[model samples]
Target: MQSKIEKHVMLTKKLALSAVIALSLSACGSGGSDDAPSAPRVQNITYEALPAMLTFNEGETVRLSLNTKGEGASGLKFNWTVKYLNQDVTFTGQGSDTISFKAPNVDMHSTMQVSVKLDEANSTKTFGFHDQHLSLSIKDLNPPTTPAHELGEEVSEIDTSVLTTGSTWTETHKQNSRIDQVDSSYNLVDSTLIRSFIVESADQNKQVVGTNYCGFPDLNSMELNASVLSIKCSSGTSSTQYFQKENSFSIVQKCDETIVGVSTFEKKSNEAIASFGSLNMQFKNFADLQTKEVCAVVATSKVTAHSADNQEVAKEEATAIRLVTQQEGNDFELHFAFNEAPNGFFVSLNSFFDENNKATIISGSYPELNASSQSGSLDLDAKNSISNMKGTFNFVLKNDAGLNEAVEGDFELVLE
Candidate 1:
């Protein structure tokens, strides 16, 4: 009996051990198959587009474009579509995996919603220009004769939102005259704009460099979008600029930190015009902004006014422009708009793309102004030597008419 019991116990132990081993094997196989890794699932898509606002002067044809990028954006086809003023507009072969858009001169969309779809993922953007009731009422201590001068208390209500707070900007002017370097910066505040800068650069004409700095909350404003930037510059000083179109945009220097002008659009086009109170910024030339960047420079020139009309006045004028940027690279192109100026006044710019892939602008002239009394012998010479080009510039304003005066300055070119 004892032997039989012992045999039964041994047989039971063996059966239990075998069952346990089988169950462990099955569990291991199940875990191995279930936990196998798989490819990542894409998420967090973002959308971007150009011409944040499209402006059409009633019956004017308009163009629109769309661009997008994000996770899960690769190796996928796209569908580009638009809804303009309740109308459906579509474009074929207009979408791509990375970058795509509808060509220029497409249908006009007074109000628009644009969409891009790619393999189970999609994004959309809204584009339109609304006629805003913008009013400017701030009385200028010294006003120019234009719609701007009529701007009274209405100026107070004007879209100050365009001028950002917590935004800062700096400017400088280097010249041969006593006012070698004129420097200043701005800080947007609740009541008035805050600013400060200095002046230097005498005798040593090595290379007069001036810089201007600006600080604003965001890139949204009539001044930044399509308005004139005015400043009061000291007599006999001028400036040129080198800018980071994508990272660093600059403004024309102010003489003694005093200058004012209404930002207006360029004539015929939606571009803005730049003017100054008792001053003029004459843009001589543009330093090739590093490739793939948009640069903004304010150039000012001064001329004596023989007539109060601001027209028919023979004055010595120097030019400068406030330079601004968005990004920098080789695959980038720049489109300019006039954010501020008077109606019918035109603003034009010049750029140079050299053999070494470096760009050098000879100069830009505002060919749309009403009169040219100071156009006698004032010319910017940028076609000289072109080797080992160290960043150096020379500005000359010849008031041979003795009718008015002029000023000039340049910038330090830094390539990153």
Candidate 2:
């Protein structure tokens, strides 16, 4: 019985083997099998750019990608690089399917480029490489732009409403002062001033100016504009005039020469006068900056305090100015002392001389100021950013109440 069962099983196996052999022979057909025929496919590789813009700006993040399409796209490899003026740019990501890089600065005369090499990284046979390259132009982002001037409903004036709401515009002027006992120096007191205005939806452009920037009351009586911000606000006896724009503001204070023991007045006369003042600051160093403006770094020392005649004691080292030199690609910040003096008065002048010598004046004392006998000049080399300031000043430190001690001296600033 066991032998009969084994014979039956053997017969079944033999039958199964014969069937497989017959099927294999039929598959061979008339054509001898050399290799399997490939399916119909397109040979070209397609890729899309993440950012379609051909012309770019500095600091813009750029990316390139090879999208899946056609035959063997998944097997494709990418070699990527960015260049500025032919120099390799810093980039990120594995150079396989996609890569990214930030646009670097391009000088006015330079060019930018992005290159990618597409090929099969892994293949048994040799294949030609497909190279993709892009040459583009990038705009420099560090350079200052000319702000747009909007016209008010009234023609011939800037639209003050266009001014950013709640934004306080600050103006700094550097010019010679007029007070004989206060701000005056042929060279030293040229660049030191502070002024400002706040933009409002409802008559925020109020003027604040006085004699020597003395004092003023608020009254929106003066006519001004949105494109050109000018406000007239007088507190009481003194009249105030303030003008503002997108980037700067000007405060014109009509000085009352009759007022004494107050801050210095503007242009006591047509002639220049001897003047001086002690330099005080709100900041301890470059790290400190409370107010939205810059104060000059004035030298004060009992040892170097010189006298301009007799009552005018601020001279030479007493009010010698220390300024930060201009640097490329960095905002030129002149170290200033924003101090609230004993008499609640502070004076500063500024002249920002760029290619056009765009200079203005700013004063922090007595709230407002007027044009001086000497209009100051500043040579600001502002190519990439606001640069250094070089000028002279004459100042005085008044302490008549016998409350606070007089601080006076020489100062020289060197920033590397």
Q: What shift in Å separates residue 86 of candidate 1 from its native position after superposition? A: 69
Top-TM-score structure, candidate number? 2
Tens digit per residue, CA lDDT, model 1, 1-416: 12222221221111011111100000011223556964343333333333223333323333433333445434234554554323444444555623222322311111234444433332212112111111111112231222322322222122322223332232232221111111111111111112211111111222222212221223222232222244323231222211222212333222222222332211111122111111113333422333212223332223222221112323232232222332222222111122111111232221121111111222222212111122112122343111101112222323244323222223221111
> Which residue window of length 10 is worst by lDDT in model 2?
17-26
Q: How close is candidate 2 to the true structure, as a TM-score?
A: 0.25
Quote each prediction's TM-score: 0.18, 0.25
The lDDT for every candidate, in the order shown, is 0.25, 0.31
Model 1, residue 295: what's the lDDT? 29
